[model samples]
Target: MTTDVIVVGGGHNGLTCAAYLAAAGLKVTVLERRIVVGGAAVTEEFHPGFRNSVASYTVSLLNPKVIRDLELPRHGLKVVERKMANFLPLDGDHFFVGEGRTQAETARFSQKDAERLPAYWDRLDAIADVLRELVIQTPPNLVEGGLKEAIPELIKSAVIGRKLSRLDLTAKRDLLALFSQSAGDWLDGWFESDPIKAAYGFDGVVGNYASPYTPGSAYVLLHHVFGEVNGKKGAWGHAVGGMGAISGAMAACCRERGVQIRTDTAVAEVLTEKGRATGVVTASGETLKARAVVSNLHPQLLFQKLVGPGVQPADFVERIARYRSGSATFRMNVALSDLPRFTVAPEPGDHMTGGIIIAPTMAYMERAYDDARVHGWSKAPIVEMLIPSTLDDSLAPAGRHVASLFCQHVAPELPGGRSWDDCRDEVADLMIATVEKHAPGFAASVLGRQVLSPLDLERTFGLVNGDIMHGRLSLDQLFSARPVLGAGDYRTPVKGLYQCGAGTHPGGGVTGAPGHNAAAEILRDVRRRRI
Candidate 1:
């Protein structure tokens, strides 16, 4: 059947694009290679009656426009807001973090930080206001289209002028420091406690290949802090039934709006006609035609594998060739008989809503990165643990909890030719051993565990080289330089095609801005065709 649009994946981004396009009365069809929808944002009953989201742990950055556009809340999606932000555990039972709706909980760590918290919020609010303005507008492109592009250039400049007016000189300096410094350096300047430093530092390296000590790692922390649920900063929540519930609801919205989805149908190739993307060919030798083809996969996967050679510009292909997104993050899911007992906080409730950062100090985290730089996996890896079953009962049998562990400091493509198949179990053991330092008897609680290295992640979720964020959120690779140095405006060189995934403008982590902007671009393109 001919369709108005054909999306090559059923991830949240693809479903998002399909839903919006279908909502606009355009017939859209999405093809997912997975058995279920939601590429990374998926939940599965891997352990028979125990459901857990194998990839993409939390949900705070999903754009609210998606919720309103797809009416997600009305369609069986309940975003359960966790009360606590996160908990950092040290060797001597000292745990410190930011929590509660007010400053008192923050004051428990540093009275001065408690007092400065409101000021920080106000500052971040002002910066966020600037970021929101930037997020909505198209990222500027220097050398696109003809001379008439001056009008868009002028409008973008005006937006910048207005944004600059919102910040004072001091605020500008503060914003720069917040985005440029290391999270450990910035937090250490404010808080004396190592646990407090590590708690905030964890955000810097969450989805990136860098360590907490990396020069621009603080920007990642800022990126996460910019997202809010109900206007509260740094608060992350989970959708009931696992992260997959989010994409499922989006797919349902698409279906109700006349969008068709086909699962387990992998696209073997992207059919191109005269340098424009036309549609795709499935692995089973079936072909579907469409006016506009949208790919939600990483640019590497799309251009390097699916889309054949000679259609893309030689230079563009080279940039994709050089793009670096290889990371050794292991997304490990386990069925636990019960919540693992923490040596420090024995009470189950203490660690229920939040994650436990295994790295106790800044030095320890740096050492983990050092280990990755030298030995492949960390001697003592940094692990973040979440018990999703504590909040959502549908995830597991009664009294049983499911744990999702995000571990890092292992290289995805090691130089020594050590494949993932040989390293996965050792990586899992390393993660459990690190967690065991804080959560005693953690090894025993696991009834069944599934470990995924970068190669495994690439096989499962199609994340390029297991880099979950699509590409590193490096300073050069972000903003206008994302994915490539000059293609951040969602417009690829190929006509009738645009990008709208984590690999685009705002980087990654469940944010729907890339998809939203992509749809808006296509709609604008359609309108221009009439003019």
Candidate 2:
């Protein structure tokens, strides 16, 4: 009935936070509304025989410190380093962007471009080194006069401020442009190859309705690029046994550390006494007490629903109301009898290890975005595909494979009156048909399929409007501006309560930086109290 901390939402970040707190010897309990422990990063059996990671398919951004600190592998977490990352099918043969042979294979398409690849990669490494500073540190508040006033509240605001002020003019300008300019424009400035540009550009719009040409897209690209797989920078890789394996490992680690986990237990409200959180009330009329409560829900869902009205500042409540989480996404899982053969180039085998990006050029990507803008759905949307079975034998029957397709331009809440139930099947067909163009027998090879739209995503995982990162990963909604301006730190408006989820600093992706940073902040406050 009582504990030192009650963590709401059994997502990976929540699990990580709980495990760390438990490691610190605090009594912790995690309450998950779903029957399963994994939140979005889950693996499920959509068909009787086929199971695949339903929401989050890859694992490149999870902080290594968490893994090392928790010794997750000791608790049944095994990360199979994806030997291959992505294979983009083009025309029929395809171009690849993952590990080993794909690099040289990509070079074969354009020798000059190939020769420049290392330099390009090296530069990204250097830039990522600078951007890496951001991964650990909280984003600098951009509020006007914010530099002065917000400083007093920051734990290391001065340190981050000095690092930021140290940026050379061109680097500063370029960094600003990278965060503000569309990924298409930014990549266009870097390369001439349509495939390379498209490959990188796809990341910029992964969770957004905006086109690759939209401003602030390059930031997404950069943020995504900071992640590594098997210790390789800017590379993407799959979890060994569907995404759920990672979550399961985290949960196991939490349990190993003596953290109590309660699945299917929903929090109806955060019970506060004189404006300080003391515990939570379950929807089932059971009250569990805790010294502090942490919510992984979106700020809107937190204050608006759980915190109750009048608990937050009116301005904060209004800002939470305005938080945008409309993601134009649709997810699909298919059981395939045979590997898809594409018309692009050297076929899909060698390149399939990497993600398959259907966008061939910035122009092509923009037109796809424009389709959603005008038609409310892409006539030819951008599709990113990964066959985890190609690397992980556990996802499908022997020789059988599962393909997880992430499609864009299908608006979460589409313009006009269209809902997902009516458009779900249609969206799945469009994605398959697109793949069919590249791989002639892709549709026929599919034995069964599971389609999830933004509505389904929101409904299933409590993801705000189905926006996976708690809310949109936009500049306005990121950093101190995240969820709400002037509240970027883990600390909420309510004293003693803190946030440690994707809604906090550094925004979304599998990165555990937010959880780590939040805990440090809380521990600091606790230490001060002891003093």
Candidate 3:
């Protein structure tokens, strides 16, 4: 069997990439290992009558350009912004950060911090704008080029530099700090309130195993805000039919463009001949050929497993081996009898609609990470609860609700040689208990539950070490340095092979920027007859 392009992994990004290629008149085929496509961004019925976003919950970073180009709304994709942004229930009190209430809310904790909040947001937004431009554009290769071929990329770099140059000294410094400083230190400079800092600091540690004090964590925070929902910058929304709706819509677009999709067809290995990717071999030994191959798999998985040994340069192989992955993520979905009643908020209102964060202070977040480093899991983990059912009623039975509990600080590889299968229910209980402490009777409200530990995440969704962003979004592994320097442009050393996954530039999330950008580069190469 043969095609123009074979996208190995029908994740949202793969589908997005195939859609673009097909739109350009290429005959594209997407191969997915799972019974259903969408990869981690799928909604499944975990409980009898409750459906929830199994891996990736909520929507924030999905690229608006992808949405506009794919005409997602026409394919039944609707993202409804949460009435609130975040709700932090501290000791005996609560804090809310939303569209209009942030200033007033911060004032209740520290008036000075309240005054600084707007500036902090403005500064972050400025930096985000600079990053937003780079999302769809290919990262300029760091390797020096000859005079002729280097001109275009050099100009692109200059334009990016000019954008950065527009910032004032302080904003410039803040931008630098965001790229290098710890989230704790960065937030400490702007806010005095721990809850306020915690509220903002949570972004720094999402899907990151490190503490808020970890260097380069501030960039992770920035990565989360680089998206907008319904034109509202830094806002997150719930897809009406869960995260699958986003992928489903992408698949609809792909199919409309004549891209062939085959699920439950696992590719065992990438077939290569003479240092160029020719196609793939399925687990069932079916060989499929393509003019060019694109991988939407995590880098380590692609290089270490599928591509395997002796196919690429040893140095390149070593770097791929060293690529950092795995996080403290533990996902839980529950069929709730009723909504959680917070000790502070004590009601099912705007606070319930937004992300209900359990990490109250920066120190607490750091301690959680510290404990996980030593004991394999935090005694008190950070939890982000989202009751998507509040906005989308179709997910649950009548009057019943479903809640997504995204917890962290559990080691991907447990200590004492413990397996996740042995401790899955135990960790799930701990997560429930932790939430119950804040929202009394919360555990009692659970009608049924589904848990995905880091191990489960890797085994189920093929998330290497369960790192949702593919690899760590650290400075050394980001931008032109991502998944190693030479391959950061989405082009591997092996010709005819390209990467369009979260492992590539712009990192992860439901955002299809990596796919869109990779497709752009692939199209350019194909048009130039370079591939």
Best by the TM-score measure: 3
Instruction: Flag regions of model 3 displaced more than 4 Å.
Output: 144-149
For candidate 3, what is the TM-score? 0.98
Q: Which ten residues in a row have the lowest lDDT in candidate 1?
A: 94-103
Residue 213 C-alpha lDDT in model 3: 94
> How high is the CA lDDT of each candidate model?
0.79, 0.79, 0.91
lDDT of model 1, residue 510: 82
Expressed as tens digits, the lDDT of each residue in 1-531 for candidate 1 is 678888888888888888878877778889999988889998887787788888998888887766787898878788877756676666666464545533664556567767776776677677776776566457776565576865776677777777877799877887788768887777776677555567667888887677787888888888877676755555788789998888878877888888899999999998889888888899999989888888888988888998876888898899999888965598899889888777777786745677767877778878888888788888888888888887788899998889899998778787688788987898888888888777788888888887889889999999888999898877777877877866777767777667778888787888777778778777777778721
Candidate 3 lDDT by residue in tens digits, 421-480:
999898899999999999999999999999898988998988988899999999999988
The sequence of per-residue lDDT tens digits that candidate 2 reaches over residues 50-110 is 8899998888888777778878778776666656666666653456666555458667666
Error of 3 at 467 (Å): 0.5
Worst 10 residues of 3 by lDDT: 140-149
Looking at model 1, the pairs that clash are none
